[model samples]
Target: MENSFLNRIKGKEFIFSTLLVAFVTVIGSFFRGIIDASNFAVLFLLAVVLSALWWGMASSVFTAFFGVLAFDFFLVPPYNSFSVSDLKYIYTFVGFIITGVIVSMVASRARRQAIETKQREARTAVLYRFSNEMAECETTPQVIGAVRKNVGELLGCSTAVFMPHKDGISDAGSDADFPLDTHEYAVAQWAFSNKKPAGSGTTTLSAAKAFYVPLETSLEAVGVLGIRTADGRVIFNTSEMELVTALANQSSVAIQRAVLTEKSREMELAKKTQALQAALLNSISHDLRTPLVSITGALSALSQDFEAVDAADRKELLQTAYDDSLHLNEIVGNILDMTRVESGNLKLNVRPCDLRDLIGASLTQLKDKLEGRMVAVDIPGDLLEVPVDFSLMMRVFINLIDNAAKYSPAGSEIYIGAKTEGNMAVMTVKDSGFGIPSGDLEHIFDKFFRAVKPRQVSGTGLGLSICRGIVEAHGGKIWARNNTESGAVFFIRLPLGDAGHGGRD
Candidate 1:
């Protein structure tokens, strides 16, 4: 009842407490035959204690002062008269009031301490929870998400997190929809750059809607955290400020960890790319030089020994030069096609195209190469039509079939077949040669990944890679695997039913 009364009192609950003390004294006086009037000081002391606990020193002072008047008028010296015969009663009355004041002071001090301690404990709990969440985060986005969630729960406000990027500060968690106008962003940027707090309550650009704190670590500031309302005003208490600063410190470490991890990955990738580029350059140089040297030798034989050489020898030299030139042209064409695929410039013209036509065209182009090899075709009649780029798809099949023929022995059987599986048209090419290494299966489609091991192959290593690129561009997948008995099998799967709109993008 006292606690509820205190809540409803606002500022004047102490009056009722003092009045109760007076009323209790009067009741004690009514029972003066059984109780001593001097004992009513205990009632005055109770009122003072109640006032101090609920209303602090202000109400306690009023209760102490008024309590003495009630005691002196009703219970002191000459009983119901405003006259004192004994002057010593003044000293006694003064002592009683002083005692009440002392008790009031002590109780008020304890009450204030209790309130402050409870508030501090609440803030500490919030801080601990926020830190725990940030510690559990394994990535930058997770850290940002933790901050938004924890801060909103603690302060009951909207939150935003911005990380420094090459373009500028951008939303990290993507839930930061607070009032961050140009001025606010500038303030946040300043806070991030200076590794300090700004906006709302700070000395720097106080007009900003959000309060920004830099997520700083020992190394540097990696990001900025901000809290604000839609209308751009939130006043934080001292404890809140401390909690946010601690959270910022914890968040900085998490973000730093994420950033360093990403940087390490990028550096590793760059190193791999550098190594790949160097290998590609060396292989391309050797291939180009070998063909040029062969063509030059044949031309020299034709020009210098024209009168001495026979017609048959001259014809052989001419054919050799012409074949090398064609090989060079094919290498250049594969490189160009790979560039187009990598740059996303290969636009496809999608329509109902016959797959058999593509297989026929590719076989016609490589008829001389597959002169002695047995070619088997097993395409289902129902799988005749598919959406594809006619020329690009022809290149895809040509590369796979030619790749199979080049690797296998003379007169080796090459199987080419297609069938419908689910909503996709699946094609396969099997070569009866030595199967690929298990370790190299995954890298078979990478550029410059040559399959020949002990023997020297006569073509660039980009043919398979280019084939993969073209098939992927047409919204298909191409993969190679070792066959069960011997050689390797390549599968190409393309979605049917107007799938991918013929790779328009």
Candidate 2:
């Protein structure tokens, strides 16, 4: 309420002091003889000072003019006109004008400094309010909404938040009337990925209408913040940018905290599950191993007497024992791998390997699942080598390919391609199969994320997630996207080993 009142006063044409100066000048002219001449000059100087302090240089000059005119007409020898009989009166008028001008000039300078000081204080107050609000925000959506509303009100602009995605940045809190354009999305993504500012008022892409700032934390960038003024002039100055950076930093910290809390909860749950798994393993190991040992002893006795018994019965017994052994091995391997991955104890032996050879090995391992599918290999012979844990990367590819084969029709085409783009080696595995549902796209790489819509498929739902873990540990990224034509495509990008320290091979 106090702010509103001050704003109203600031918007006025003249301040109270300016009006007071005019009032005193008029009354002083009327009561000329009663007022002492020398003292009246001091009063005129005070009026000029007040006018300048409240209403600026123009008001102070007008006050000085009126003071000189009043002194000459009412206080000189002539009572109602500008005629001055006494020559000493000339010095009085000259001295009065000089004093008023000097006082007004000084007052104007002081007023300007005071106004600037007040504006700085107001800006700081706004920043404080913004920081406090951002600290309370938990999720990305909440932060985006709060920031948009607050920034729009504070800076008087239409605000937006754009989050970086595979293709571009999607609007976080945008209305239909102000939808983000493609160019804006690209600029926003660039800013977000690089943790730099772009668009209006920045060195890069300053011709763009909107300003893009990266919502960067100490670790990494969360997203991009966009703000556009109604008048289209960039409203963000150096101080404003600093304030925005501070706000973004606070928001980043809050988001990081929320994510960490969620992960901690998940870890606790996993620990509990691990205890249950250990008990189950203990029970299964004892129960199943005893039966398997008895069956193997019976098979050995039967094999020794095979020549005297029926050949068909002996063959069925041997095949049954072998299949059970293979099934038991697979279950044990899966359990061990899960435990290693969950405990973060799966160390990778990183090395430079031919992507073509890696892809071929992965495909060979899953050849049974591929069945009648046409596996088209598009990797060039001269493709650059990638730095990776060869065995881990093979497992990642095999899992992705196996997943595609399971969801796709027998006769569908599966394309595996690799190439070098920028400083990364890009690989894509695509299948002409059922595309991922829109709702499941975001969680495709989450542990135990299965498509509920297609419940008929049998899976443990940990393939993609495990693949993501393996790729990320090797300083690479893995993500899934729906193909434009049909089916789903999983993309992997590894920094080229030959590039530089931060780049993957």
Candidate 3:
């Protein structure tokens, strides 16, 4: 847009300069009889100065040369010929041309400075907008995308950015967009390695098809930016090359910022993972020791006093040993199941199964825990069978029921319900216990995350996390929320149609 406007103005200047010279010649002719030839030469000089000031170098020089010709033919003593009547007129013509040339040079220099100033302002505005856009970019891909968009628009060329990784530079899968053969890639790598521009416009590797510029900052080079014009023409004039260099510098900073952000996130994740491992170790050691101690004590007592202990007391001790061993077994099983889920090694045996049977098995297993609680089941009799891995889904119910029994107070009611809605089977387990804290609701299913407020209960906090993993693996989802009245409700929603159809590994 700016270029077209300047071109139109230049064209008008050409026409106006020609007309002004011609108008001066007509006035000189009308007064030739009265005015001296020297006076007419002065008038032509005035026209030359005005042309130089107003219409710039080309127009001023054109008017100077043409006006001198008209003066000799119309106002000089020899009115119709290039031949000078006197030797003095030759000096005047030569003087006129030299003065006009000098003035035109000065005027053109000033015009060049003005045009460059305007272009600099334009480049600054473009760079400022690009910097702002890049500042908002938080990821490496986003920064690259912004680079492609801005560079493509600014230069009207195809652009590609290659970032360094541990293995090597990543092309970002831009082959179809900006294809580079072995030689072109070598040129790009050289630019990056040497921290210099290469390829078409640069002195280095000038024969290459695309211009390769290193995206460099004060610290280091982050990547290489490649630009290829469609016609394979060299288009990087002095000002444009400067603009591109400024853009590359800005992009380098943004890319470095994004890379640092990604590294920071990885560091944070590693810190969190270390913390989780420590928690797992502590929970496993405590859980494993408690049951082992109980079993050992019970067995030692029974073994030492088999004859001396009374029959009823003997039976009680034996039962304690058995129950503690079962508890120990459950702890080990939970750890193994969690490992399977985490490692993506848990394979499903998909089959059609009734929800009632699964709930029955879960309740029977938890009968000892729910001894005093009033349990209610509300599964509809006509509910259809669900496709799932029977064993994994059964474990889901057992964990939910057992978790409810642990959290809820004895004698409080626990409700288990299931129903189908729009091809999805929704099951819920509600417990009349102290509800989950609002702040902890979201993190409840995170591995090893126990409720902060309720500290009375103790177990490895892996059951709900395992449940979520299993449910999701079976094309389902699970979530928990507190009821308005009292306690908390856990909901599991599974797709009834073709869930676990492929038997996931």
Candidate 4:
């Protein structure tokens, strides 16, 4: 609405400029009765200045021609016809047009500068916004998101960001662009590998459907930024092309920041890994030895004297040996789970299974751990069967429930529940334990991730990672977060046999 109003005002100004010049020329014609015909050119020259100042060069030209014709017809000898009686008067028209043209050219120069000034301001604004957006990005995907959004806005075109990979660019799909085909993607690959631009607007590979530019820092070409205009133009104007280059440069710097952040994270992770390795060595010497020593000592005591000990003592010793051996077996089971996940060697024995049966079987196995804890089970009465590896799924539930029992205070309630969400069977395990630390929430399911600070907890941190591996193998999702009231909630969502969302397909 405001734009139309401003345009209307400009239209009126141009019209008034034309009319004002015409009025001045008419007035000059009457005054020529007293003034010299050449002197009348001065009055029309004023009209030319007015028109040029308010409108375009073409309007000024019109004004100049109108003035000369009026002067020749009204003020020159034989004052009514275009056929001038005196040929010397023709010089007046020539001088008049020359003055008008000179003024018009001057006005055009000013207008050009004004337009350039506006464009510069606009470009500055775009750069400022681009910097601010890029500054907030902390990850590679976030940087790509910023580039996608900003490029779409600034360039008014389709855009895609392709990160570097072993073979070529990695295409994380974007809705903002129609994906390039094999030939076009090859152009992008060339741009990235060569650390130069290719495709539509560039000198190289002009036949490509989209323009591809390498997002390069001084260290390396991190990725490629590709764009295609909506107007089907094979090229951009000078300023536009410069803007795209600047965007690529800015994105390069942002991606460089992300790269630096990742390196810093890796360094920190390496440090943690060293500490964990030391911890693992300690655990091997302690955790593995303690149970083995118990089993060995009990067996030795029983074998050493047949009649020296009572039958009750013999039975107790055998039980202790059996229990320690079970403990050792649990530790070995965790090790095997880690091996299976890392080596991708887990083969599932999948079948349609009931959640209630799985939960019951898991709880039966965890009776020792849950002996002192208050347990709540809320499996929905009509829960659907899920396609799963039954034994692995049972282990997942056992680990989760055991983790809950281990972390929570003795006698605190552990809640295990299941319901339906969309086409998924949603199960949750909640414990009244100290919640996961905020920084460590995302890393909980990572293998060997202990809490930031050491704890009195006795087990290796492989339980949740095993659960993650098993659930993912079944095409399910698993995540944990602190509950609002207290403790933490671990959620498992698995598809109900291709009902929707993710499944075997």
Best-matching candidate per lDDT: 3
lDDT scores for all predictions? 0.80, 0.74, 0.85, 0.82
lDDT tens readout by residue for model 2, 1-505: 2233344555353445546655776777676777665566777777788788877766777778776776676665577789888777778778878877887788888987797678678877887787778768766577677778777787677777776567666777764444378887778878887789898878988877788888778777767778777788664665566667766666566556655666788899999889767765665576467547756965886868878757787777777677567545644554555666678988989887878889999988887768788999997657458888888899789888877887877788999998888888889999888889988989988765676446445445567778888888888899988999989999999988673232233
| Candidate 3: 10-residue stretch with minimal lDDT | 496-505
Task: For candidate 1, write residues 156-262 as lDDT tens digits.
Answer: 77888889889578767634467757887888899888888999888888888788888888887888988885455455656667777777787788788878877
Q: 1 or 3, which is superior by TM-score?
A: 3
* True-vs-predicted CA distance for residue 493, candidate 2, Å: 46
Model 3 CA lDDT for position 5: 41
TM-score of each: 0.76, 0.46, 0.81, 0.66
Cα lDDT tens digits, model 3, 1-505, are 2343446688787788779888998988888878668677778877877887777777889888988888888778888888888888888889988987887888767877887788999999999999999999999999999988898899888888888767456674343557578888889889989999999977899999899899988998899999987667665777778889999999999999999999999999999989888988998999899988888987898889789988998889888889878888888989999999999989989787777787888888788888888999998766457888888998899998888878877789999999887878899999988889999999999998888435656567888999999999989999999999888999999888854222232
Candidate 4 structure quality by residue, lDDT tens digits, 282-326: 766777898889899999998899689899999999999998898
Relative to the true structure, candidate 4 reaches a TM of: 0.66
Angstrom error at residue 478, model 2: 36
Q: RMSD in angstroms, candidate 3?
A: 5.2
Best by TM-score: 3
Model 4, runs deviating above 4 Å: 1-43, 50-98, 159-214, 219-228, 270-278, 300-316, 338-356, 363-390, 396-505
What ranking of all candidate models by TM-score puts the best one first? Answer: 3, 1, 4, 2
**What C-alpha lDDT does candidate 3 achieve relative to the native structure?**
0.85
Q: Candidate 3, 103: how far from true, in Å? A: 3.9
Residue 143 of model 2, lDDT score: 69
